[model samples]
Target chain A: MVTLEILAISMPISVLLGIALGTARVYGNVIIRGIASAIVITFRGFPVLVTLLLIFFGLSDFGIYVPPFWTAVIGFILCSGSYQSEYVRGAIRSIDIGQSLAARSIGMTKLQEVLYIILPQAVRRAFLGITNELIYLVQYSSLAFVVGVPEMFAVTKTFNSLYFRPVETFTTLAVVYLVMISVLVVFFRGIERRLAIPGIELTTK
Target chain B: MNSNIPVLKVENLKKSYSGRIILDGVNLEVDKGETKVILGPSGVGKSTLLRCINMLTLPDSGKIWLEGVELTNPNTDINKMRQKIGFVFQDFNLFHHLTVLKNVTIGLTKVKKIPEEEAIKIAASALEKVHIPNTLWNKYPAQISGGEKQRVAIARALAMKPSIMLYDEPTSALDPQLVGEVLQVIKELSTAGMTSLIVTHELHFALEVANELLFIYNGKIVEQGPPEEVFANPKHDMVKKYIASIYSRKG
Candidate 1:
């Protein structure tokens, strides 16, 4: 339940942030591009656990108090957003340059080009990577236990300590995660198939 | 500006990349309802010249006038100006995600801000002009033949009702069998009095459609005159050689 809540909160935030940052990196002017690059590099290079610790513990020393659950949410968003942005950026760049010129020749503004022409195609190309990111988010939700969020793994640990049935408790927890992740994989595969472009595979190969 | 002012005028246009000159001291004029065909060997700055007219590739230094508006001026509203000048690329740069009707209607609704119903009416008529059957209107570009794709591209441009159309090798990318269909649409557009500047390698089509033919060599207009005059009495040695080579290849 706790894992689901965090995933629900963080997934949308990460996706939106990823798109904005990715677009800025590609199309923004020098200053905005530099800033977006800095953010992506910082979050991607730092460990998610370190990011959580900084937000939850280190910031309290400076008179800033963020609750443990929100800290985990923020950390996941920051880390996943950076990775997702790279996926989106790669997808956007993969589109032919002629697409932009075609839009411009028709008098569509830069914003209109991105919104109507570029983004729809780019999102289609980036769909599989985005689905993989969601799965990673689900597994990484276990890290929330370090911040006292009592997510799935943390709850399992508490149950095992009290009942002293380590083998059975851990087995149930493993099965639960497997089932949840397997369901996610199946659902996203269906979406990929449904939205597939005819005569054109999404694979880079 | 007088009524006799050329619909499109380019003067002293120059461009270079990596210190290599692409177009140097090029000039052109297209009167309203005139069809001018630019003929040249490959890599002779023909494509660059067309791109400059629409500002798709900005010229290094030039004066471009469309309907007497100075397009090279920094303060000019380029987007609005571009709406009046339609361009068709050799590669048929259609939005793959959009169906043919949607592709034609996108500019009208998005940039021209025409209502959807009105835009559809306009787009349908434009597509009809290119002889793209109504059955193919809902199909994606990928589902169509290369020739159909080119016609759809032309329709997408024509839907804007541009004052002047620019075509960059409209037939070069097609299979030989498909070339005639695309060229036929262009010929119809010419007969219908659409002002167009075309870059093409089809010597026969150029002779048929061009009111004036321009032969460019090494970023310069080496010969330009009525197609019959230039073909029968070539003044430049380079133009003569180019003509000979094309005919010999066909022979």
Candidate 2:
């Protein structure tokens, strides 16, 4: 339930941040592009464990504090959002140049072209990449245990220690993770079909 | 609007890509309701001229005016100027994700900010003008034939209610059998005084519909006159040879 809580909250935030940064990197002016690039690089450069640790402890340097669960969630969002931005940027570049030309010829401003023509196609094409990111989020939620959040891995560790049956406990953990990923894959596949366009490709893979 | 001022005009238009000149000092003017057809061999800057007039391909240095308003002025609002000119591409360039009706209405709702119900009504009439039947309104671009796709592209541009239309080899991409249908639509539109500038290789259609025919070579209008006069006389060697080559291919 705690894993679901983190996933449900952080996934949407990460996806939203990814879209804004992706668009900024592609279409923004020089300063905005530089800022977006710096954000993506800084977050992606650090290991997720280090990020969580920094968020949990580093905020104390400024005389502010965050709980372990919230820190884990924030860290995951920053880390995952960087990768999501990369996928979104790649998808945006894949749309043909002619699409923008047509949009401009129809008197659409640069912003309107991106908003109406480019982003809709790009988001659809980014669906598979986003779904992959979501799958990773499922596994990364386990990292919350490292920050003392009583998520699935923390409970599993307690159960193993209490019963002294490492193999059974760990094997059950693996099965549960497999089921979680499989359910996500099926859910995304249904939505991808609904979003599919006749002549456009969402993803080749 | 002054009746004497041309609907579209270009002065000293020039452009080059990678130091290779595409348009060098091309100039022309089109009054309201005048149809001028430009004919040239491949890569002769004919399409570039149309694109420059539409400001799609920005000229390195040039001037364009629409109804006496200077479009090439640095301070002009380009999007607003573009709204007054309709451009149709060779590949039909319809929004592939949108259905045919949505394709026509998108510019209306999104760019013009017209309400949805009114945009649909405008789109319906525009589609009808291009001879697209009611049954195909919901079809996707990939689901339709090349002829139908071209007509839908025309309808998309026509829905803007532009003062003048620019066609860059609109029929060049269609199959031979499908070319006549698109040409017929262009002919009908021109005859009804749509005020168009067309870049095409279709000699018969050009001779039939054009009030004036221009032959461009190496980024200059080397030969131009009434369609009959230019075709009947041998003023420029390039024009004469170009007409002969096309005739040999057809004969």
Candidate 3:
């Protein structure tokens, strides 16, 4: 359940940060956009392993003694958020400019236009991409074992070595990951349906 | 509601895109309870003019006043002022995600801070004024016909209770049969004394609705007078040509 706990916490943080990052890149002034762009490029350019290792060990280099579990969570959020922002940025661009103009015509402020009009439409369009990210998140959480956070894979590895039950222990780990991924997919499917606009084509993949 | 002050006034409006002028020295006045139609060929800056009056497109060098407030002034609280000016676009720009009723009430709730129940009451009356029955109020824009969509757009604007309505080719996007439905609603609203300025190519509809017809050519009001006078004695060659073409098409 530690795996689930990490994912539950990291997922919401990453998604919120992803939205803020994408909006900054799209709507911010030159300096803010530059900062958001630089973060996306840096996090995305390095491997997820590199980020995890850096957070797990490099904090010691700075004399920041964060717990290993929190270090893994921080790493997951930063890396996953960078990837999610790319999808969000693409979705925001796909929405019609007419939506913004219509909102503005009725005297909605610029921020209100983004929050009430543009983001709702963009988030719906970004759902499929976000679901794909959720699937990756299930798998990515397993990487926490490398930081000695004792997630599912780490526990399975220890059990396999102690009991020498490679078949049972590894297979159970595989099934758990499978169940988590399937549940994540179904949950996102429900969200996609609830958020679907009247005219949009709802694909059932 | 003073007699001397026009509901809307534009002075020496000019706009250019990349040095190619669209509206050059355009000027006009719309009095309270008057419907003035600007008849022009497409690309003569009619849409730009309407957008400018709404400040959606800022004029390059000019001034606009709505009910004695100079809109061009930098200190004008644009969002606050915009609530008092209604604008309808050619392609009915309804909030697609919202139902017809919510589309009309959204501005009331979000912008004007009206309570939901009260906003719905205002929306219902506005929708009724535009002839949108309650049955269709819950439907999204995609579920409705084009004429209904345009009417909802009008209702969305009208619910704000603006001093003047600016319609930018309100019926140009409709099918021929559907065009009459939307125009009929506008006619009813105008005849009932809604101050509106319409930019459209529908000469027949213009004659039916407008008290004054302003013929625009190359971004200038080439001829202006009562519809009957402009049709009977068009002063400029451009106006004469435009009226003749419409009459020829009818035959």
lDDT of 2 at B216: 88
lDDT of 2 by residue, B168-200 (tens): 999999999999999999899999999999999
Q: Which regions of candidate 2 are displaced past 4 Å? A: A199-205
Local error of candidate 2 at residue B64 (angstroms):
0.2
How much of the true A–B contact set does each candidate keep? Answer: 0.71, 0.71, 0.57
Q: Sort all candidates by DockQ, best to worst.
A: 1, 2, 3
The list of candidate 3 runs beyond 4 A from truth reads B1-3
- Whichever of 1 and 3 has more lDDT, that candidate is 1
Model 2 chain A: ten consecutive residues of lowest lDDT: A196-205
DockQ of 2: 0.73
Residue range A109-169, candidate 2, lDDT tens digits: 9999999889988888887898798789889889998889999899999999999999999
In model 2, residue pairs whose N, Cα or C atoms come closer than 3 Å (at least 3 residues apart or on different chains), thus clashing, are none
The per-model lDDT (C-alpha) reads 0.93, 0.91, 0.89
Per-residue lDDT, model 1, residue B249, is 96
Q: Which predicted model would earn the best lDDT?
A: 1
For A1-205, candidate 1 gives per-residue lDDT tens digits of 8899998899889988888888899989999999999999999999888889888999999999999889999999999989999989999999999999999999998999999999888988888898888789888889998899989999999999999999999999989989999998998888888777665676655
Candidate 1 — which residues are off by over 4 angstroms?
Answer: A203-205
| Per-model TM-score on C-alpha atoms | 0.97, 0.97, 0.97
